[model samples]
Target: MSAESLTPTETLVLLTLLAEARPVSNTELKTLGPELRAASRRKLTRLGLVATDTSVRPFTHELTDDGWARCRTLLGADTPPRVAPPVRAVYTLLRALGRHLDRADLQLYEVFAPATEEVAPVDDTSPTVEGRIRAAYRELAREPGAWVGLARLRSALADLPVDEVDRELVRMNRLPDVHLNPEMNQKALGDHDRAAAVVVGDTPNHLLSIEVA
Candidate 1:
């Protein structure tokens, strides 16, 4: 669905759900005090931005694949200006970064530092190594191939200490091979990737030219 057609409430609702990956009960949503949770779900469903199965009690709401994609697009469209406060800019950058990494990679970062009150799975109790790695690649698939190099990847870790940067790179490099895909080429790279690369301000020629095996 197009962002222009989505009401403010629907947009907020979808963003809330995206922040919380698991299924959210109606009661849980009500606590958000948005007053439009139910209405937003109904509206989003009509727009095919969300799926609801009232077959069971309490109802279950989850964003469909299309819903998730639409949400990402909307969020990208509405991103605040770069000159915004540091905290807001950081959050914006993280969301943009999430678009390029795999789900596992996103989850790993969230597991270590969730932006919201939600908690990620504890270490040792999370998904299999392959599962996490595939998630990371899924995130990367959302971006352009040219931005998935060591330098660009390192910039995503700028908030970390010098020592932590190497650690993160090591971990990212070792993600399960199954997650890598040759089909995610340059076209998939979005404006956010370019902006991030620019912000980092040091593109390594060798890293940008490397091909995925």
Candidate 2:
């Protein structure tokens, strides 16, 4: 569906559902406090951007593929280019962290530190790199608590140069890994520090230890 074809309400609903991949029930939609939920749903349905299934409890509602395409278009230049390493690495890290943390915490972290980069396209007219990146995140999100480390993440990002790895790490640190809370920032930095400590012992992984802005 084209963005131009969407109404204001329909656009809002589409954006919300795109950001949240899970199936939302009609009841949940009502609770969103938006008086336009019903109206928005009707518009989206007409545009073939959403589908409702009465077979499921709460009446499962999910965005169609066309819906996501329109969302990507709306996302526009704000979207980052696909970077494979971070997607793999973040998933692995989240899985490992989940073994020791709560599932809610992991989900919260994913929401805050969303993977923005899309994979580079091999040819014109092919799916944009971002689509592939989104697919990778979906794959990882499906399998919570899958263990991955820096080494494994690096392997997935074999196309990136060594300098790019450093750059990516710096960029990642600047992002809110577990939300924008100051406490979360401290914890994420602490986690990185601990990981570096293990690697460098008394020497310390100075590069990793550097504070992120």
- Per lDDT, the best of the predicted structures is 1
lDDT of 2 by residue, 1-213 (tens): 544465444555665565555466767665652333566667777777787786987676766656655554443223223535543453354345445435343322234222443323334334533232223333433243232233334444446564555434433433432111222334445554434221110112222211111
TM-score of each: 0.41, 0.34
RMSD of 2: 18.5
For model 2 the TM-score comes to 0.34
Output the TM-score of candidate 1: 0.41
Clash counts per candidate, in order, are 15, 8
Error of 2 at 192 (Å): 42
lDDT, model 1, position 49: 71
The 10 consecutive residues of candidate 2 with the worst lDDT sum are: 197-206
- Once model 1 is optimally superposed onto the true structure by TM-score, how far is the C-alpha of residue 172 displaced, in angstroms? 18
